[model samples]
Target: MTTLDGQTALVTGAGRGLGRGIALALAAAGARVVLVSRTGAEIESAAQEIRSHGGEAVAVPCDVLDLARFEAVLDGVGPVDVLVNNAGTNAPMPFVAVSPDTFDTIFDLNVRSTYFLTQAVVARMIAAGTGGSVITVSSQMGQVGAADRSVYCAAKHAVEGMTKALAVELGPHGIRVNTIAPGYVETPLTAPYFADQEFRADTLRRIPLGRLGLVAEVAAAAVFLADPAAAFVTGSSLVIDGGYTAQ
Candidate 1:
């Protein structure tokens, strides 16, 4: 019964999939959630679902890549106790085939957005003098390279790097920064690839657990890291990859 009672959390990319799961889990744990995503309708629907479950949530349409708009979105929501940097993009292409544009797109969404959003939110947390948690949703690719995932791996590795740096800088301010690395979660974003039976089987084989992860499982990890239960945790990556990286 980990509770975030009286805490306010903002979850980026909450329109669907892992983001949605994290948002709902936080709300269920008694945190007032702010759901942000480019899709206003989807976020609104997610907020409504939270309300249906007797949880509190608000919807905000935001494109995390827009640094200018990032502050505005936070301002609209007011003070936050937790910031989940879950917005990211993946351009799966062989290293040789990856173009500059693809690299830029992946870095912009996955790395840049996480960096600046944490900056903005930390400013607010420091001002309020309230200890806060920053959770970045990274991938197992950050720890191990996968074929045709060069750009994504780069971005996630950058995420891990920043997480460690920020933990050092912000720990003095009572702000904890950490990352959660998920491996082969079954989500809409990965649905098409999983539909390929051979690809899905191979993925499962790599995960020593013998199955793909669930959105709820990842959500639970996010909630744990964000909760005061992990107050002493920082600069650490809690890998929820079902032993995918153990080998």
Candidate 2:
């Protein structure tokens, strides 16, 4: 495992769930972390938790949807050696019932935010000649479609495509871009859905491993992709879905 010692990593949506887990993992691996989220106090608490473990971390309250501000992200974050685009949301709805607002909301956060945020960070990386790793948090839905999740699936698929294209374009600069697509990760936002036994049982049946994924598991993958040891990896989707997509 390549240590990220002396590296500075910026992770969006670091207030909770997979984002928070990834931030902590990167910090544990010796990277100074910048925790970004729309909520200030939440990420601040998370940052303090990292500091409690003697890891360097800073809470940066930010909305990645603000592309304009991302142009100046370096101004607030200084130099980011690793960029994790993890801020996203999903709303499951029947395809026919998906409204324009629902579509826009999902796409704006999942697709547009991911595209421009990476653009800003990679641009800065290029100018400084400091190549970095960009790990986008995608979903198994990106690879296969699901009922009532049409909009969400589309957004993730768009991210999957964008990541590949960006990886190719940024490879010349030594910047690596890839995505981590996890399936059925148990998080706060998903705990409610799993409360319904039918949904839970069906989801479990599809996963060969017989359980939902853990945030720590996904976080571990993010660390691997961010490490310098993965220098040769790019335009790839590392799926941590317990063989859900294998079928």
Candidate 3:
């Protein structure tokens, strides 16, 4: 049985969408969850929902892009048995149109924040002598490229590489590191893009599943990765792209 009873999980960007879904999943499995997001209200609402469902959760509002504040956030939470680095952003622009500012913004959140957060959390995990699970929420774009998504792709690709390297470094301490590379998921942030006729059509045509993924679907995958059943699974990507990249 895959159980997370008595575990503690910290999910970044848990205000809504995929992060909220992942937090709910982990809490449902009996883990005490800490929900982190830049918006205080959003994260508080998420925490309330979990508590209403008989789960343990705390809402912490902090901009993850500010590395110092983020490190402090982790310090307040103490040792985490599971760390879900789900906070990230994307700016789709033509390769030629992408400016240094655009590249820096995406990479700062998607790659830099994730890297440092993992480092801080893992240090506590090692000191506590408790092997933990680190799940980085990446995207199918990491594995393949797309039009007007150059910077996003670059950031995700960097994450894929970082995961592999971290896994090898942490494996000796029994800490596992991996990423969940999902396809186009219907979220508030992505709804606008999917609403466009041309964008929706092109996206659906590429996915063999012929539809967008649900936040719950991605959440379930994270649970699987965080559970003990996946003890031997490290440095791997659970691709949930509905065959979008299969071609």
Candidate 4:
């Protein structure tokens, strides 16, 4: 593992699933990890898990949508060297059935809050004069749309656009901005969806690898982006989709 011994990493939505996996990987790699989630007990458990393995970690509970409270809590975390904008929510519905509230709920957390949170973190990185990496956990849907997922596609696509713009703007400051787009990863959030045999078979058929992605697989991508070895990589999308998007 490329060591991040003295660096600090903050991962949002880190209570479980991909966020938890990424937080664990970063901690194992030696970065002091700050795990943020709306659920206090969950993140606290994750933090304790890291500490059990001799890694440094901190758990912070806050709703990312609450900007004022988030910012206030962030102030106490000190300098962050790597930021993973991983907190997001997706509620599937047909395009015509999408109410205004549904759209707002999806876009607010997936796009709006993520955009502003990154802005805040990037600003602090600039002020501190320390170069860093900003990684957003996007989705293959961001590059291609699917039925009943138009809103999610829109939000992820917006994230892709924002990342590129930020990369160009922050390149001079040595801040790298990129995204990790995963396709149908098997997490607690998605396990229920797989209960339908047809859906599971159809999903696997689309992926050339013919299998669901592992949390560790996606977490490793986050580690790669944060490592010094990836210093030259920015404004890029690392798609861990088992070739799903390739088709």
Candidate 5:
């Protein structure tokens, strides 16, 4: 009698971090999860752990930056009830030092890859007549700007805009599209920044909660948005920023 019983969820970037957390959460809720990532060992280990816990899961390793291969991987995995587009990367550089290569690299993975992957998933959802949830892992930077995060902010901002637009266009079909904008979360990607005393203090000071967000916290938000209880919710964002955006 779990909320997601019998549903299938596909979570990209599922090898580790928030993606892995979300995948585990969905499976715990009774969904069969397709764990996708660029690294085979990482996704496989994650999928095995889910299986050991009595939840159904499979690993599909493919770099999402390659849209064609990503689409092919999705085709093989079949239709999904939920899609978490969480594959993203950030290169923090001052605006003056930001080059075209830096911008494209970040946007290609964060925005472009997410955009096309969601498109493919929604198309399958439409064809099957079984509407699904599309959740993109955005960031607090998407809502409020930060120093040396110009490209990251730009990319996440694009994701937010697309989510809202997609929700508007797909709501009539029973589809839900939303983004989860989380503050500094303790993940492999952000670990280095946290290791710096000055940076860590600066980040924590901005959060009213006085702590970094955990991957599980963000995952829980994904579960809420994916559940049938959120059927009426769309074209919105759930910010898990620990009150950072309040100020």
Candidate 6:
């Protein structure tokens, strides 16, 4: 039997990229997945792909930044056994040139959404009297500072803090909260940056693995943390940066 058999998982921003990869991985482990995203078409397409692979999945279109709509989306999905707060946005601008609006946009989606959504999901998990996992997709930026990523780093740092606090508060209720910090995964969001030969070379030089990470690699980490194998683990951040942080 699969590790996640008989569980229900919700992966936000699951239309594509890292979120989609995590959703598919969870489904492969025998969980019925709920794909949440702002774009209905993308989520639907992803759900269909999961179905084609004999995995059970459904698409739910909702913006994470909108609490009301997010609550509605939660209601539509009913009780969720796992909630992957993977929806996030980043505007890479120098600290001196960053605007309030830019900061708010990133925090609203990355921090606010994660905060409230976890509250909602943990409430349900408490009521059901069963343990559940809440995994947030953080970044290496959260751990270390980087140029042109001040706001992004702040948001992810907040996410890491929240993860710890939530884990402490929810431990009594059998709910696990953790953050996955990826170094530099190859995704649609980072594709442009990776396309630049100079940038790519610089990034590769930092990673001891000498290559960029795959979405599937990050997804596998999610699966490990979400499954019973990690039952004793909580209030932690898993760094999947291929030795970038090691240096």
Which candidate achieves the best TM-score against the true structure? 4
Per-prediction TM-score to the true structure, in the order listed: 0.98, 0.97, 0.98, 0.99, 0.98, 0.98
Q: After superposition, which runs of candidate 4 have C-alpha atoms over 4 Å from their true positions?
A: none
The order of the candidates by lDDT, greatest first, is 4, 3, 1, 5, 6, 2
Whole-model Cα lDDT per candidate? 0.93, 0.91, 0.93, 0.95, 0.92, 0.92
TM-score for candidate 5: 0.98
Better of 3 and 4 by TM-score: 4
Q: Could you tell me the C-alpha RMSD of candidate 2 in Å?
A: 1.1
Q: Clashes in each model (backbone N, CA, C under 3 Å)?
A: 0, 0, 0, 0, 0, 0
**What lDDT score goes with residue 7 in model 1?**
91
lDDT of 2 at 132: 89
9 Cα displacement, candidate 2 (Å) = 0.7
- lDDT tens readout by residue for model 5, 146-245: 8999999999999999999999999988899999999989999889889999989998898899999999999999999999989889999999999999
Residue-level lDDT tens digits of model 3 in 10-70? 9999998999999999999889999999999999999999999898999999988777897
Clashing pairs in 1: none
What lDDT is reached at residue 235 by model 5?
Answer: 92
Residue 22, candidate 3: C-alpha displacement in angstroms = 0.3
| Candidate no. 1 TM-score | 0.98
lDDT assessment of candidate 5: 0.92
Off by over 4 Å in 6: none
Error of 3 at 46 (Å): 0.5
